[model samples]
Target: MTAPAPSEKALVPFVSVENMMRLVHHIGIERVLTELTDVIEADFRRWELFDKTPRVASHSREGVIELMPTSDGEIYSFKYVNGHPKNMAEGLQTVTAFGLLADVSTGYPVLLTEMTLLTALRTAATSAMAARHLAPKGATTMAMIGNGAQAEFQALAMKAVLGITHVRLFDIDPKATEKTRRNLEGSGLTVMACETSQAAIEGAQIITTCTADKQYATILTDNMVGAGVHINAIGGDCPGKTELHRDILSRAETFVEYPPQTRIEGEIQQMAPDYPVTELWQVVTGQAAGRRDEKQITLFDSVGFAIEDFSALRYVRDRVRGTAFFQSVDLIADPDDPRDLFGMLQRAKD
Candidate 1:
């Protein structure tokens, strides 16, 4: 027996992974990244308006699962995401996610979408946006250490948003580096695969680290980092998973999305609780300084904040409207009578 479709009020737009890929192809990936960067930056400029809180996390021996929630008073957004570093060994993704946006007025969901791909896009865009303010002027080369699923997106975002012309790629696994290099074929940027992390960052002005390790491991030593470089360290998004050495952080001027959250999950977790750091939002709004001198070493310790996910959801919602890129799902229950839930259930069996 076929069931009748739900009412219009019950339908919510849902963007599947396939549809998300289609939408990305339709709008063009570079354009999407650029637009997302702008949207996230605009949201950061108005950061004071948003309700901010640390993501609720459930930690395990394997990895972490989290619910990141935030709202701008009008629209509320939340993401359900998981990170398991060992999943790759078991032929699964290290990170996977989905998110929802709801209208605060009526508490009904407006949009639901897969966020695994969108997260990569937004994280890369956020990195590029921070580099725009913190990286050295006319920076061209970026050393991408830990070339994994996020490697290509980070490279393309830097290319599209910051005009980076070269990417030096290195990974602990040679195959991973090759994968990134091959995916970037004809991307118009020079791709160089290096044997060592040190070789990768040789002449690069911007260095990004995104490894999928679930422990305290140092991917970048203090001596490996040099002056006048922007370090986008995004791998350390949990309690003990950090990439850079503590000495490196001591010498660098670290910027973060939210101090309270960053202290719990970002690279700066290695530092003291009272360690002085600038907020990226403040830098975006010109309330704080970024890259004060040529010799400055700037670090963006990104732990993937909720507001960033909010902005990404907001961007997707606006783009998917009235398009074939999303399908309507009956996410809400709409009874013929507003107060007749039992009656509606009783009628369902007929």
Candidate 2:
């Protein structure tokens, strides 16, 4: 006779990439971004309740692979992600990821899902959340310096969350800029394909740099950044990688997610060990200031953090419930008796 089916407790919910895409389309991308921003911001407000740590990374000349983990007493989560700048040259994704959520009490996974697209959404939402507090008032029109997989998401997040009405796109590869413009054709925001980074930033209040280079390079020089503009630098996320010139960091009042991690991987890695930077959580909780004055240069040196991933996973776990977006995977083995592990294996052999 065939073995009995696994118990409900032995199964875990899994969301495939296709299901994730369907879920996003089902809820609408802009609404998903807006809701994710709110969820992330809510977590930031209670940041002290979560256990945080820097991501463990394995670096190579070709790329970097990392494991980001965090817990909020009740639930535990971790994401396995990789960043390979050279992958694009080989027709592969520059980044890819998957994450899991588990119950802290039993240490058993409850949800597992692909994070490549989820990460893009969470990254954009986090940038918009930081900008909500830091960007200059009445800001519209953001310059997207790198029009790659993430460019359109960033533009749409700013529009949905901050009400930005226009986006200027630029890339060293004109085809990439054209791709972004084409994807955003009906996005309800004026999209301009710019000739240069300088042209992209002209008449734009917010400038976002998201290039994929594994070495030290200056995407934006000090002179290119005028006063009072908000710079969202997301490309520099590893030790040897950086996007903004060193002098620009000095001019802008920089903010970050976590000091320990940012000191090692973010644009601030170029600065001194004791570089004065405010934590974004402090700004979210009103303990510190954000965008203190109209003419102040505000820089959000975002180096994707684990808590944000945890927040995103938490959001997905909640949203996928009672929906067909996830399938149950028989991941655990439950024995008929607690101590019948050998008997269970023998019985399955029949």
Return the TM-score for each candidate structure. Answer: 0.98, 0.98
Candidate 2 lDDT tens digits, 61-156: 788999999999999999999999899999999999999999999988999999999999999999999999999988989999999999989999
The TM-score, computed over Cα atoms with residue i paired to residue i, of candidate 2 is 0.98
Cα shift from native, residue 40, model 2 (Å): 0.5
lDDT of 1 by residue, 47-165 (tens): 99999999999988888899999999999999999999889999999899999999999999999999999999999999999999999999999999999999999999999999999
- Cα RMSD of all models vs. native, in order, equals 1.0, 0.9
Candidate 2 Cα outliers beyond 4 Å, as residue runs: none
